[model samples]
Target: MGTTLHPLNPSDANLIQARLSELGYYRYQPEGIWGLVSRSALQDFKAANGLSADDVWDGSVEASLRQARPTPASDTPFGEWSVVGFACSAEMNPRKMVVSAKGIVVGSMICDMQGPLARSSADWSGSVLCHIDGRDIASKISLRVSGQRLVDRSVIGTSTIVPTSFDRCS
Candidate 1:
């Protein structure tokens, strides 16, 4: 979007990386450096869109990218998600989740299930039957993919518990 032109500086490179990532060609987080990863992503985008693979960023690429639509989180093949959440001081280790392109959600490495994807004006989510304190309650859960290292989960499972994020699992 900037008029800085090709041979983009770090700031422009960062912007390009962010855009490319949104288009699903870049995997790593935007670091504001025009490195190999950035160039590769750009090249891939060009090839996909039938642009000349000159290994350079220019107005044509920018224009096409600007017109491109972002892929939904539900469509992306998510990574191996794990969390050691604490339930009443007991560490709930091995709690995991993974979403595939076929709409299958594998979780805790023990759960192989898929729930209907529900969309609202606020966000995208699906319901998973959670067994909390002995009752299986259908709970709302959202999974968001970002960069390379993280896929965030926001659980609006029950009114009794606050929406929980399990992103800091080590």
Candidate 2:
């Protein structure tokens, strides 16, 4: 992997970095790369965990990842604290997407859903999801939101996708 160390998923790196910082490793930056600071922290963690101190996640790493995760499955609510990513695609053809949305923020509490849901509002409420690709098509939807600027991805499930986020505006 060159000098560029990697995490299982890009999202995990942020978690790992955050965890390291919490453990008092002052230099750990949440930049999503297993660099020197990360490596040093990993080494220290390995030693503490009674592993080889090789600075690799190996079996111990896997176990640590599992234990470090906040939940068994990702079911966190979409708080106003994060950004949202929404997209729709056909199951039969993953490449053929009908709708896509990115960088949408949750509506503030003061705004009404209808005001945001309506197409004419200049505010971020309705403007976020206004560019939906295919409104009428029944497709496999892939929706995700990041609570801390993609540091933690909150995968949106079918039950969570509201008819309109506008309702959530207020």
Candidate 3:
């Protein structure tokens, strides 16, 4: 198993810890690191989320974090932007999956993660329903651009990654 816990930034750790806490796995200060508190928190999170009792980060584990409902931002942009690329790394593991999409900013991008079959979790995927400037993007299927690879675009700040299949809409 290539699972290793990396030191998380204070803010990132706080966010992760907070998320875990919200899911009823409280056990950390949200300082964001592999300290005793975080480790315990991870253990709790794993058990609650139906993951291995071991404190390791796998796709399913990370998905639980990512699937947490996000606080609605003041400005949400939900529409066809076009799936360009997607990249993700398991929280405990350093490896990442980069998915590239066609350069078309469609309505929404949905992703269904086919996690390792060994893990006992549904292959999770859904569309990001963004609310931008009071407009609803609703849902749209995402298209794979150039396979799983990084793209020149940035997936941070004001971007929502929804996991939907790549199917054209009317």
Each candidate structure's count of clashing pairs? 1, 2, 27
What is each predicted model's overall lDDT from 0 to 1? Answer: 0.50, 0.35, 0.37
Winner of 2 and 3 under lDDT: 3
Top-TM-score candidate index: 1
Tens digits of per-residue lDDT, candidate 2, 75-132, equal 2112222123332221333222211112222222121111111111121122222213
Q: Which candidate leads the pack in lDDT?
A: 1
Q: Residues 7-62, candidate 1: write the lDDT tens digits.
A: 35777778888887776666678878887767766655664455654466667777
Residue 48, candidate 2: Cα error in Å is 1.3
Evaluated at residue 163, the lDDT of candidate 2 is 30
lDDT of 2 at 122: 20
| Models sorted by lDDT, best on top | 1, 3, 2
Q: What are the candidates' C-alpha RMSDs?
A: 11.7, 17.1, 15.5
Error of 2 at 98 (Å): 55
Give candidate 3 misplaced runs (Cα > 4 Å). 1-7, 68-170
